[model samples]
Target: MNILVISGGPRKHGRTAIAARFIERTYGFHTVDLSIVDMPMYTGEEDQSSNPFVKSLRQSVLDADAVLLLSPEYHSAMSGALKNTLDFLSSTQFLYKSVGLIAMAGGGKGGINCLNNMRTVMRGVYANAIPRQLVLDPSVFDYDRDGLNREAAEQVDGLVEELKMYARIAKEVKEQQLI
Candidate 1:
């Protein structure tokens, strides 16, 4: 299925991206990392209707069957880049769309706040968000010659399973007649 995984963490290669990539690979789903999409902060002054970035991003979201929001906790919330990305899209962009949320953190809250906050935001946009998502503890890291820790390697399988299940069900139901 066409899946768009928006990475909400500032660090492009951080744990959140890694986890997202793992899930993408597991499902063999097509994903677009919004972190790499590159758009200036919304100013309202810019006509999103005409903005090429907004246009392309919106096109991708519209084309995708589901969206995977991978976020990190920032001030008890999801990252601003992510929030802004969603904000830029607004209700006009996401209505009737399916979304899945994933969050990660090094410690403490482990990004639950990020997940919850993004979920709330999704609600505001009238998105049909998937109920299941992955929350990863950074300690799962098994740092190797490449990077990350052993725990990261361990968590990969389970997280991938969750993503795959969601994708399968969503793809089937989305393709089938709604009951």
Candidate 2:
């Protein structure tokens, strides 16, 4: 499947990017790091011709069978940069796509809020967010900076599996409609 993973943290080497890298390595999914993507703040007046980066990002979302969104919790929610990037996408861009969410937080409690907030936003975009989610504490990666903790890794595996399953179903349904 053509899966797209978006890392929403400003720090390229932060936990959010690390999780996205793991997903890319394990699944061979394409990843877009917001830190590296030259996206200006979405101002609701953007045209495809005016902003190449936003246009390409929108096309990536439209082309993906499934998407994995990794965000670092900031102030009990997703970072402003991620939210702004998402603002550039309309509901049609994400219609019926399967989405997996991973929320990393400085404190474990904030991750849950971030996940819930992401779910609501995904719904607005008409994306089917898998019920399985990963809520992580940054401290969990302290011991193994190169990898996730065992339990966190297992949860990420489950989330990926769920996204694959849902993406398959969505594709089948779309095919049937086309037929």
- Number of the top-ranking candidate, with lDDT as the measure: 2
TM-score per candidate, in order? 0.77, 0.93
What is the C-alpha local distance difference test score of each model?
0.71, 0.85
Model 1 vs truth, CA RMSD: 3.4
- Cα RMSDs, all models: 3.4, 1.6
After superposition, the stretches of candidate 2 with alpha carbons farther than 4 Å from their true spots are 142-145
Q: What's the true lDDT of residue 150 in model 2?
A: 76
Clash pairs for candidate 1: 140-151, 140-152, 141-149, 141-150, 141-151, 142-148, 142-149, 142-150, 143-148, 143-149
| Shift in Å, residue 134, candidate 2 | 1.0
Residue lDDT tens for model 2, 1-179: 99999889989878887888777887889999998888787767636436988878889999999989889988878888889888888787899899999999886466887888889999999999998888878765743556677777888888889999999999999999998
Judge candidate 1 against the unseen true structure and give its global Cα lDDT, from 0 to 1.
0.71
lDDT of 1 at 80: 86
* Tens-place lDDT digits, model 1, residues 84-155: 877778767676677777777765866778888998999999886666656777666432432345555455
